[model samples]
Target chain A: MKPKRTGKPEAAAVDRDHALHLLRAMTRIRRLEEKCAELYSAMKIRGFLHLYDGQEAVAVGVMQALTPEDAVVATYREHAHALIRGVSAGSILAEMYGKQEGCSRGRGGSMHLFDQETRFYGGNAIVGGGLPIAVGLALADKMQGRVRVTCCFFGEGAVAEGEFHESLNLAVLWQVPVLFVCENNLYAMGTALEFEHAVTDIARKAACYDLPSTAVDGMDVLAVETAAARAVAAVRAGEGPQFLECRTYRFRAHSMYDAELYRSKDEVRQWKKRGPIATFTQKMKRRGRLADADVKAIEGEVAREIEGAVAFAEACTWEPVEDATRFVYSEGRMP
Target chain B: MIDGEQALRTITYREAVREALREALQKDERVFLMGEDVGRYGGCFAVSKGLLEAFGPERIRDTPLSESGFVGAGIGAALGGMRPIVEVMTVNFSLLCADQIINNAAVYLYMSGGQFNVPLVIRLATGGGRQLAAQHSRSLEGWYAHIPGIKILSPATVEDARGMLWTALQDPDPVLIFENSGLYNMEATLGADAGPVDIHQARVRRAGRDISIITYSASLYKALEAAETLAKEGIEAEVIDLRTLRPLDERTFLESVARTHRALIVDEGWRSGGISAEIASRIMEGAFYELDAPVARLCSQEAPMPYAKHMEDAVLPQAAGIVDLVRHMVNAHG
Candidate 1:
């Protein structure tokens, strides 16, 4: 794990200890996701594996800036978000494998991972479906006076959904504590952002709702954390909601199912040059915050975590055929 | 847990629902209400009247007209550990929330593979007789009953209206309680108090041995009236009210059919592929030997209910319509 300034305008409030913690959390997510890619090719995992290969900084940076009381809502491209928020890597991977040991009991498959303890709401498969849910969670928190921020992460393409506008209005109107973090990877599946949206500046739309918003270079982990920290602070101070437009990109295709018809090889190459994990590692090596030995140790630790998850899933029992009729009605007392 | 017996009360359909909401909110800290006008508006039918003043705004929430948004939010709230009672105003309005109700909430329990249980209760006023016209008046509970992983109940009597909500709340899956607008003011006298009604069984409201009349919701009384009129003519007709539509009580239905060897399904839904058709088909499929004659059915006319009062009376099933249909069936069977 390493922390490098990367020429980002450092928020002076961020101390060395906090920076180190963010770096470790980000490394864990980056390594776990990197392993998932290999696992996908090995046929150990199947279904729609939308890897956050390049955009690890957005989830790690933003989540590290929030408190434990916060609730997280995310899209299908959210393995990084769940891991960064403390959901066990084994649970997420087993869920991807569609095993009962996984979070959501393998019911949600790759897209609906939920950890009630982590306050990680779901891996909502619908493009913009998780936004309103985030608002509802924020509403519940506000009404209960829990003083916990509800941080929601979605792709840049989610801007096209009706739920996006509806959730924004409700969150701002109610003065709820919501940090709407848009992991703007600049593409929605096979379609590029410019081709679909009339206005490319997503933060300006947040302004339309009279809400405060910010746009940040999502590749730089330290930069994202600085912006997220300020925004999270403002929202927690009862200043209503704040939107952080993370200018990032996914290195892989939208999903495993995509044939890669939309983007050019040049575009993928360009985004890869700024990949969060690689960029952060280079800076950390330069700053003496990390060593070659430390990197190996981190990778070894992550490999073991994933191995444990696979073993756990293998040992998991399938729900009995008769039990299929069990949870359908929670009121089992009925005659 | 509140004892089901003592909680039951003999009241009008409207008051019974109000008491249920109040009790649910009081009984559980996790229970809350959210809908289009559930708060300051006092509910469209005042079924949740004084709830806002009693439970305050936290428990009784008012939402914008975006049905999909609010209903979807209710599902999320349920997932977030709160029991939400979402009122859709009317079944006609539920169309707007269909995506959230049908796609999201209905399938969430199974889709999550038992990781989550949506203890959500969606209450809406359904059926016709208010002369609210085509857009406002339609019985669409049948369409919802088509979905899996959800429980559907159409409560016509006061006991059902009151008891169904509690049962729905106790159930882990999403439950939609459709209360007919026409039955709101109708009162019922249940001995000293309304008995705790089970949401899963068919109740034999009237007894006879010659012919069986199966119906539910607003059409229950009409079918019973038809049965009474037939008794005067020496035609014994049994009436069964199907309280819940989703888990259809086939045993009770088949038992009645097997005994009388005749069935007349009365429904307020449109004639094409309606619930009545389902009942007739089930009887034919399961108990073919019991039939004295092919199962008869009397359903609403296949036209969009017209606004004219006389036209409305003509299109829907009435006591006279059921009575005439039963007489024809009886004559044919005899």
Candidate 2:
């Protein structure tokens, strides 16, 4: 499939305030993830922590086009998605701490954060697991005649799973309104796209299902937002499902335990030069939209927010062992 | 066949199950049935015939042969506030979608820390009698019963076949209904107005004082036949049909064993690590003191089901095997 570049930004779309806001959102994820890595080393936040280091633009940008009424299904490395979807950083951090006050009540450590109020379906750990759920959510909306979109986010690794093909076929067949956002970050864990897939054009796979698809520069927050807004509008207007392959990279290892044995350090350094946060900041400065003082102030504010979130997580009470067996089956709604 | 002046109606097990689906769709606007060939194809076993015209494609949805995808979609639909009844053609085919059934549907409620509960019902035909071979015929209800978060129901009777769907739809968590394929052609008289049945308890099909023959699904009929043959031999046998496999009604069989002072479990599933072993263990745990003889179990032979008819019949738990086991137990205890 051809990469859609019509919505590509040639100039600043917003003034100083909006750019800084987006910058802060991406930086919040960066800071929180950095703290998470530190905490992992300190033996505090235990469990598989898949950090969303370089791919912040994808989550922040795509989520901007969604409303609270819309549903979201995300992969395990979804700290940014949960945060952008209005889940409190304290709750996300508290979940990592395994505290009951956290989102998901501490049951889902890092990979399974869920919030019913925001319609965040999960932090699904299984590769390609969320695609069907997203399609089903869209089916519910279509059957109910609700004008809403279900945006599903997964790694490019999911394209190889049978559920991906099945879900795409079902979504298009039923005319369900879903925006399938595939984060094609060039690697599936340690396997590069070239090594993993015979054809690395992930968006092209949707053509077989007759769904409209496009490839976008995932590192540019503005381009991702433009593509996502267009896709979300198409889905909301009773059009069939749309697929967006966000071409990006994860600067960190797959999880906290990776040794970075696959790719060379030079390649990592080259990608780091075009990191989403840095590239966006540079673009804003070049356009005379954001000042250096604004950048420092944004950084300071985000640092404080991360500190408060860490403190909140540290102080939150642990779930009582006696209540461990609850919620297996719903206890039914109270009358 | 008319049972009385109360207006009896006879229906096959397949029809009863279909009736249950129709009633569920008619009663609840939120409930819908989706499966491979559940629509125009009228279900693989012809159980859902005419439902496509009645409910239309919107509700009587047909799906591709993607078990995991559709099953996961059913769970997602349930979470999205829709009650979906997903039919897998058979229990053997359900293995393809077991991940979604086990991990997502069963684990979502607990994994999400009570934020979500999948109110989904999955119905699949199970058991062996025809020469459908190994993959086509499997009694995996026992395997599903091993899970913690989901409920398992084996509808052995026509009433249960007609009644279990509505109750299963009303459940707040995932529920699996295993219909024995061998019993689909079996017919029974139903009242014109039959409704939902409670899914939590076991029913005593026949009462006797000598020994308790506990079983479920298609095996219930075998146990009842064994009870009859034992009656002619001057040994009365109480028969208990366990409708709910999980959260098993240990009280019913335990009380029956207390009265008869003997217990024999007949399950169509394999003997080792199967549902019979669980019931036997429960019997030993709860009713050991009251037993006049050691609890005996007659399960399917430990092997993959062969294709031949006689071999398949021999591999399953049958009436003759039940009679032989019960006779030995009664003779030894007496």
| Interface C-alpha RMSD after superposing true interface residues, each candidate, one decimal | 2.5, 2.0
**What C-alpha lDDT, on a 0 to 100 scale, does residue B38 get in candidate 2?**
98
lDDT tens digits, residues A38-78, model 2? 98898878999999999999999899899999999999999
User: TM-score for every candidate vs. truth?
Assistant: 0.89, 0.98
> DockQ of all candidates, in order?
0.40, 0.66
Model 1 alpha-carbon miss at residue B23, Å = 3.6
- Count backbone overlaps in model 1: 1
Q: Which stretches in model 2 have alpha-carbon errors above 4 Å?
A: A1-7, A332-335, B1-6
Candidate 1's residue-wise lDDT over A50-140, tens digit each? 8887888898889877777788888888888888888888888777776777887777766777877787777888777778778777777
lDDT of model number 1: 0.81
lDDT top scorer: 2
Q: How many clashing residue pairs, candidate 2?
A: 0
lDDT of each: 0.81, 0.90
Model 2 per-residue lDDT tens digits across residues B86-195: 99989998998898888788998898899888899999999987898888878999999999999999999999999988988888899999999889999999988887
Find the 10 residues in a row with the least total lDDT in model 1 chain A: A1-10
